[model samples]
Every structure is written in C-alpha cells, then in structure tokens.
Target: MEHTQPEQGGLRESKRRDTLQRVAQAGLELFLARGYEATTVDDISAAAGISRRTFFHYFKSKDEVLLAWQTGLVESLRQAVLQEENRQAPLDALCGALLKLAADYDSDATFAIAQLLRSNDQLRAANQVKFLQLEQAAFEALCHLWPQRRRRGRLRMVAMIGLGAFRVGIDEWTEEGGTQPFSQRIGHAFTMLRAELQVASAAAPSQ
Candidate 1:
C-alpha cells in the first residue's frame, strides 16, 4: 500500500485552511467593493468558488468573515505572553503580544480590510464582540501567569489596566504612524495609568 496516512492528514488540514482563506478573501472583497450591508453570504460563496453549504463549513455567516482572523489571535497572543524571558515585566509581556498582533495588520491586505471594517456598521458590531472575547482571553492568560487569583491583591485591576493600555496603544497606532513605535506607546500607556492610580491613592482621605 502507498504511504498515504500522514500525507492524507496533512492534505486535509491544508485544504481546510485554504477553504477558510478563500471564504475570508471573498467576503472581504465583496464588502469593500459593494459595501458591507449589500454583500450577502451567497455572494461570498459564489466568489469563493464554493456552494453555500461549503461556505457555512468555513464560516457561519458574512459577519464572521470580517472577524475571522481573531479566532487564532487570542491563542497566539497567549503564547507570546507566556514565552517572554525574565527581563520582561507583566506589562512588557502584555504589550509585546499586543504589538506583535498590531504589526500583523500593518500590511497592505490588512490595511484595506481595516478600512472596510471601519466603514461598516454590521462588521463593526461583530468586531466589537470579537474584541470583548479577546479581552476575556487575555484576562484568563494573565490569571494563569500568576496563580492563586484570590490571594492576589489586585488581580482584576491589574488585568484591566493592562488591557486598557493595550487598547489605547492600538488606537494610536492605527490613527497615526507616530514618532514612537506601538510597543513604546503600549508601555507609555501602562506607565501613565500607574502614575494616575498612585496619585489617586495618595489623594484618598484616610479613615
């Protein structure tokens, strides 16, 4: 018999990824060309050279196509955060992961896709939900980084602070190329939040 087992498995996985890619590309192109609201699932399926049933196998709906990349991003970010060396602080680890993800979107393909997402209301709503999911994933990863969540003095506060800083950094990076890099902005945001928190703590009246 031919040695078809491993090769067959690899081919199957590659074909699945290719199907998803084609569906995503078709959806994005239609969204950009005819506008997001006007583009239907049928339109994308036809463009991708697949039937509607096959399209559903790759993505649930057209909204999913715009938010597709996010499926793998949370896991990628988690890996990046966990693999940092001893020199990296918690904030540094978080920023490094977030910045790397931002850099992934700096390409021409991603730029056009971003513009489409910015202009489309349906895509915007879906994108917002996907972002919330990512934030929760980040929180879970941070909790894993420092076990004993209940014993930690400010676990939730610290998690929220890191995520907020990363959000601001992303907005700044997208709006302008800026003098500084995205990673630097992420660090600066965290530093500013820490300073403001310290000031507020000091200003509180003691009982």
Candidate 2:
C-alpha cells in the first residue's frame, strides 16, 4: 500500500477552503433572500458566524462574494494553460484551457452564476464588467507564457481574438431561452472563430 505524507501547506489550504466555502454559502443565501444591494457585509458576517473584521479578511466587499467563483475559475484556467505540456504555441494552449473552463462552468457553479446575473440588473452589469476584466487577465496570462516577440504583434492579435470569442461564447451560453450547455455554446463559438480565422489567413496573402 502506498502512503502519502501530510504537508503543512496542504493543511493550510484545507483550512482556507473551508473558510471560503462557509463565507460564500452564507453570503449566497443572504443575497438570494434579502437582495444583493440590501445585504450588507454585517449581514453576511453574522450569517457566517464571523466578525466584520473576519469577513473583510476573506472578501473585500459583498459584490466580491458573487464574483469569487468567477475570479477563481479564470485564475484556474490561466494556471492550467501555463502548465500544459509542450505548449509551444500560445494559441493552442489558451484555446485548450478555455475549452476545459467551458466544461467546468457547465457544472452547478456557473449555472448558479448565470441565474444570478440574469435575475438581477445590477449583478448583470457587474458580471459583464468582471468578465471583461477576466478576458484581459486571461490575455495577459497567456502572453506571459510566450516569448516577448510573440507577444508583440500577431500573437497578441490571436490572443485578443481568442478572448473576444470566449466572451461571445459566454454571452450565448447565458442568454435567456438558450438551452445549450455552456460547454457546447463556447465550443460553437470557438468553431466559428476558427473558421473566420482560417478564412482571413487564406485571404491575407492574396490581398
């Protein structure tokens, strides 16, 4: 039988996960019942059985509670892309990571986020803004993995285009009456982008 050794970092990570879950669960329930704007930091802290100071330690603001899952998801995608084996082409790694994210978000977390954003106008706006930020972050993360020359012109263009396609994919997935899973929607968007890129690539030299 193989045995694994316990590590100090693992223990700290476990504790951090527990605290985050507790805070997020409490915050979500309060937001759902009392409305997001009406729900204060104090309310969330009380519900989580934590003090205001403690809540501040975990989350900067109530709005950030709703954004926590999204921010984490984006960071995870970036890390996955950075860590992929033999990723000589930044575009390939980015697209693959994005596809994985699409599948991941097809789970309950992204569904719940979609519901919340759709239900509330303020949250919708907030989510839109946050997604744009995430797209920029994703581009920068990918750029970091590439050499400086690749990040300068055409490679940067590819990243921008890829990120824009991802935004479109997310919008399609979250749109009202859209029955498709987020993964499928995002995949479709990527397919479309790839087709367009191929066409542009074919035409550029002839022009």
Candidate 2 steric clashes: 0
Which regions of candidate 1 are displaced past 4 Å? 1-9, 85-89, 108-111, 118-121, 151-153, 171-192, 205-207
Cα lDDT of model 1 by residue, 71-174, tens digit: 68878777766665535456556666676766664455554565566676776787777667667666666667766768344545555677787767656655
lDDT of 2 by residue, 141-202 (tens): 76667657645576567667777888888777767435787778878888998899789898
Candidate 2, lDDT over the whole model: 0.75
- Cα shift from native, residue 70, model 1 (Å): 2.4
Clash counts per candidate, in order, are 0, 0
Predicted structure with the largest TM-score when compared to the true one: 1
Instruction: Tell me the spans in candidate 2 whose CA falls farther than 4 Å from its real position.
Output: 1-17, 33-35, 83-89, 118-133, 140-145, 148-151, 201-207
RMSD of candidate 2 to the true fold? Answer: 5.3
Clashes of 1: 0
Where's the lowest-lDDT run of ten residues in candidate 1? 151-160
lDDT of each: 0.71, 0.75
Question: In model 1, which residue pairs have backbone atoms overlapping below 3 Å?
Answer: none
